[model samples]
Target: MPTASSVIEIPVPADQVWQLVGGFNSLPDWLPLITKSEPGEGGRVRHLTTADGGVIVERLQTFDNVARTYSYTIEQSPFPVSAYLATLQVEALTESSAKVTWSGVFTPAAGTEDAAVEALFAGVYNGGLEALRANFPA
Candidate 1:
């Protein structure tokens, strides 16, 4: 499995950050690339439309409000990954600071294995984290 991770420090309480993104289908609220998010099948499935007219479908695997963590698996996507699993976790670093880590592991799609980590996982995770950080403003 190829794994990619991205971390960003936010100058806000962990609870506050989690409140913004804790919901399994809340990607549209914070993810810069997500244009809209639609829920399906009792909120377990999410259909996301990106700004660039791309669509992705994902399923919520685990969501722990007390732990401030959530995990999801991609069911359909344009990225070069199969069997992809991603987790978003928020940890307190201080009374007013927190770190958010977004990570995922996947089996690259066929011949795209070589660049999947950089082009898909890292690009999406890091870019999204950076956008979140920008929104919070350290």
Candidate 2:
């Protein structure tokens, strides 16, 4: 399986960041790549629509409100990967600072190279973090 992770620091309290991101269906609130996230399966699943009109469906795997963390798996997506498990977390660096990490592991599609998919997810994670950071200006 290929994996990718990205970490970013935001000049805001962890609780606040968590308040913004802890919701499974809140991606559209902060993630520019995701224009909308519609809930399904009693809110355990999310149907995401990208700004470019791409569709991705994912299911919530686990959630920890106290820990400010959540894990999810992709059920359908345009990305060339399968068995995708991803996590998003926020850690308190200080009373006024937070560190956010996004990571995932997946098997590349039959014809895709590991590095290619890794790079793709890495770019997505990194770019998404940058967009998240933009939400909290230093």
List per-prediction Cα lDDT, in the order shown: 0.88, 0.96
Q: TM-scores of the models, in the given order?
A: 0.94, 0.98
* Tens-place lDDT digits, model 1, residues 65-103: 999998999999888778899999999999999999999
What are the RMSDs of all candidates, in order?
1.2, 0.6
| Winning model by lDDT | 2
Off by over 4 Å in 2: none
User: What 10-residue stretch in candidate 2 is worst by lDDT?
Assistant: 129-138
* Ten residues in sequence with the least summed lDDT for candidate 1: 112-121
Query: How many angstroms is residue 52 displaced in model 2 relative to the true structure, after the best TM-score fit?
Result: 1.2
What tens digits encode model 2's per-residue C-alpha lDDT throughout 23-132?
Answer: 99999999999999999999999999999999999999999999999999999999999999999999999999999999999999999899999999999999999999
